[model samples]
Target chain A: MPTAKKSYSTGAFWFVAPAMIVLLVVGIIPLLFALWTSFQQFILPKVHFKGAFAGIWPIFDAPFVWLSNYRDLLFDESFRDALGRSFLFLIINLPIQVILGLIIALLLHRPGHEWLKNVTRIALVIPMATTFAVVGLIGRLLFNGDFGINNYFWNLFFGHKMEWLADPNLAFVSISIMDCWQWTPFCALVLFSSLTMVPIEIEEAAKLETDRWWHILRKVQLPFLLPGITAILILRTADILKMFDVVFIMTRGGPGAATELISIYIQRIGFRSFEQGMASAQAIVLLIITIILSRLYIRFIYREV
Target chain B: MIRLIRRLALSATCLALTAGIAGAWTLEEAAKPYKGTQISVIFLDRPGYRAIMKMLPDFEKRTGIKVNYEIVPYESTLEKEVRDFSSNGDLTVALVDLVWIGTFADSDYIVSIDDLKKQFPNIFDPNYELSDFFPLLLNAFGTWNGTVYGPPFDNYSGLLFYNKKMLKDAGFDKPPDTWDDLLKVFAPKLTQNGKFAYALQSRRGETQSCDSFMRFIWPWGGSLLDAKFKSNLLSQQSQEGLNFRQQLIKYMPPGIVDFDHIEAVNALAQGQVAMITEWSAFYSTLADPKSSKIVDDLGVAPEPKGPAGRKPALGGFSLAVAKQANDNQKAASWLFIQWATSKDTAKEYVENGGVSGRQSTYKDPELVKKYPFIEPMVESWQQGVPEFRPRFAEWPQLSEIVAEVGTNMMIGSTSIKQGSEEIGKRVEDVLSKAGYYDGKKKLAQ
Candidate 1:
């Protein structure tokens, strides 16, 4: 018996060892290096962390100057307007993605719907496979103020062309529409996979009793799908905060800093400006904000097991 | 049977040993061949790259150094260079942009070519007349204190490009000489059919901070930093310059704040703008029938004088030896750089679309007859003032002041007065934080 137990331990160790090695090399080491770098005035190749010990000075000093960076962001009416715009985008886009996904999933789960299910699933997931740059470029052409399809339609319908990406009010909405168009299918796929796990007997019992489809969905199916919906929201929110390649490729935080997000602002400081230390400080702040928001989402939405 | 098998195996082993020896000998011969060692040269995919490609086979035959070149896009080139530099490997050579010279110098990523002067005197021949190369082009960027950090590779001075057909139709036979003439004559001719009169990059990041603002600011007698490391972007001259730019915005494309270098280029090419302030490299683009509608009709002129006369900002690329490279690599790189920029080589390159820095190349009779803009461009480069990119460690932080405040002014979020003041305050904060504005240095009023 003791020999068998020893063999089992050895087997487990062999199975886990490769993964652990990979994690250490790719993730753990880099995380530690970045954390160490955040506190020092280190440039590439020449001044690595080994040469210097700047302690927590960057952390202390960063806040004093970064207060101004933050003040510029918070006090600028543009930022506040963008924040309000983001909220509007979330309110309009998020629920629709989840609900549409749920409906598609439910419809596809019907008995003997195999071909339809596979086709729908594949079609919905297509946008997820595209590169963000390609997506943004395509969006730009379709949303360009003068020659865009949207403006063409507006002119056809209302006798006047609308500058979709040029106007401050319309830019955020235009970006959100593109975002929703691209990501709604992803949400749908997640909920659909989760919906497949719903027990046939419980759903069958509910359907047998209730003549109304809406009643069955609200009372039985929605409660079952709550966890999937919460998971999608949390994942999407995390991504939305770091949303860069699309906005960067499309407008570059412009039409007068109208679409400038915190990520874009931090990047400009780091890469374009070359303030490696200040950029790190701003990055650390952004990381904190992201963590707090993620926590809030998890607490409010994923309360129960 | 056992004896026979052993004998066969021994024979096989002997054959394998002989093959290995032959392979190693061949490799040694290849490495030390008179045909010269093959070295990798990486450059950004600019017109100069094409020029180098045309001239490399001749260089290989003449110098016996086989050139292996990779021309990547600008973004990818920067990434690859930084990666190669950080990895501390032997890179033969790189065609680096002037803007990156400071960062490269600070990091000691590239080596100095001073020793090559003694080793290869003919190659570094004093009579090749490096002095005649526009001093701004020669030393405009990439130096740290007094050390010459890089050799100018592909060069262009910023020039004002106008559609000749459009300007002629507007009843102007010549390019605008003064700022007032530009606004009064060219602006109206340039503006028609809801299209802009002029297109200049105003997009709120590096372009706004560097090319566009510098174009206006210097000519209007404005400066970035005063003697005390205090920001003087709020000076009256700077405000006037920025205000004039704001007024220019009215005659520009509607989404002026979003325009970058490429967008401005495209607008002019597409006949959306009559005049554009752009790099001389755009001459190649303008001359390309496939790219520009106004190919034959494009007129090149020196950037106009304002309160200050014809202080065109110099924009160009340079070659630097990687500091981490071994001695052999350094020597080989210097040989390649010298050969590539030589008068004969440069003239051949200029004949093929390249805008070379050598005054001799521009004056080449064949080149002069073929490319009329070459002489005007040379004149422009002579008059051009290479922006003294502050070599201080805090340049990156200082640059942000230009981008942020400059961007704000473009969007009309701040008047030039307020924007320049904001720039001053922000720059002071940046300087103070960086320890440059410590008590010993008297603050600029």
Candidate 2:
């Protein structure tokens, strides 16, 4: 019995080794390198090295400035604006996505809607499956002030065209709309799957207790949905905090830095400005914020579930 | 029989000598050792690259070198090249923008042409007359400090592309010859009933900095920096230029702040706007019947002069050998660059929708007739500012700041004074941090 158990354990360890190695190589190593880079004054253009291994030596040669890169971020107005914009994007987009997703999930959960639910389930995957960059391009076309379909309809309905991408406020809203379009379906599918796990007997008992649908949902379905909602909050918060491709592709943080999110700002600092240390510092700060937010979600929301 | 044999040998020797003289230095000979070597470069989807692609087959057939390239948009090209260089990736040929010369050279990401020639002397063609390239283009686009890093390939000069029919309809027989004329006379008459008089490609990137914002400042005798590299944006001439641009905004399309080169070109091509100050290379697109609605009515002219005489926007790219490439690959890349930019291939390059930097190419009567934009482009090039956008390692950072403030000025979100002052302050900060003021680096660079 002991020999058999040891053999099983060995097999399991071998089975998981490849993924663990890959995670270490692709994920953990880069994270550590970035963290190390954050501590130095690593201007890319100033670093001079040659030969095949030159790419690896720049980090070693970079002057250590301790926490000055992070300290500079405190006084940087553009960084502040980017952070504020990212938060505003989250504030505007999260609630719309959550509420719309819940409503869709509830409707699909209704007894007589199996065929509709089946079709919607398939259709909902399309937006979630679409590439983030492609979604941004689609958003650009959709919100184009001159010849976009959105403007055509806006002119038809509002009797005037709206400069969706030109106006800073409208550009933010346009980005939010694109984000919700891409991600609300994800929230819906998750919540819908959670709804399936709700015991039929418990639902029936709640219905008998109160003829009102809202009462039954509040008392019975809400508890069951809490776990899925918690998962959504944690995941979506992280995703939104790091949202870059769509905003970058669509606006490029245009119309005077209206849509420049934290990620986009980091890219500008690191790649465009060649200030890798400052960008690394900003990235670490963002990571810390993401961690704190995730902890809050898991502690408060998950505790209830 | 002996006399006849002697005559035959003499004739054979003469034939051999003629063949040797004719094939003295060819791309085929230079690329002989590097045949079958696959080199990679990043190309844009612009007319010049399309021309290169059209001519690529002949190059491959003659040289036996396989050229692989990734076609990316202009905005992404810098980042892609930087990432590749930083990682020592497989990019053999570096397609460098004019502004990137300082940065790429400072970082040692690309080898200088002289160094490449020294390293592989056998591969260089003696007949590749580097002097044939316009001196202005060679200095601005190809050289950094004192070293020639690459040869100018895709060259441009800002020219006013307008719809002749629209100008005629608005009671203007000719394109505006000055900024004052454009704003006061042509603009007021042309702008009406949802049609704008002009469109400036001002999307918040290098376009805003180089083409839109700097386009105004340069012509008005306003420079981005002084001889000491201090910000000159708060100067009287600069303020006048900014104010003029603001005034002209009334005649420009709504959402003009969001227009990129493509959008601005499309506006004129589709007759939505009367005129656009665009790069000379875009004439091909404007002339193509499939893309342009006003192909028959298209007219080209040098950009209108301001307080300063014709100081048009100068922009272009050069092809260089990547430092990361091995010797053989570097040789192949250099050979390819030489062949592409050579005076021998200049006419073919121009005929295939490319704007060649070779002065001799433009002087060809056949080429000038075939491409109507050539005369205006040549005029602009002759009178254009060399430092249109400051070429230095710190330019990318400074350009971002200018782009933001410039766009804000265009949209009326910020006053011209406030925007210009803000830009000056930020430019000082970037320059200070780069050690320019402290004399750690030379001020001239």
- DockQ for every model, please: 0.22, 0.64
Q: Clash pairs of candidate 1?
A: A101-A188, B190-B197
- Model 1 residue B145 CA deviation (Å) reads 3.0
Give DockQ: model 1: 0.22
**Candidate 2 on A1-305: residue-level lDDT in tens?**
55655346788989999999899878987898899889999887676434434343233467899999999999999999999989988988888999999999998888886787799889999999999999999998999989999999999999999999988889888999999999999999999888888899998888888899888778888887889998999899899989999998888898899888889899999989989999999999999999999889878877453
How far in Å is the alpha carbon of B91 misplaced in model 2?
1.7
The lowest-lDDT stretch of 10 consecutive residues in candidate 1 chain A is: A55-64
Judged by DockQ cut-offs, the docking class of candidate 1 is incorrect
User: What lDDT tens digits, residue by residue, belong to model 2 across residues B111-215?
Assistant: 998888779988888778888888889999989888999999999999999999999997889999999999999999999999999999898889898888899
lDDT values, one for every candidate: 0.69, 0.89
Residue ranges of candidate 2 with Cα displaced over 4 Å: A1-8, A48-60, B1-23
- Clash list (residue pairs), candidate 2: none
**Candidate maximizing TM-score:** 2
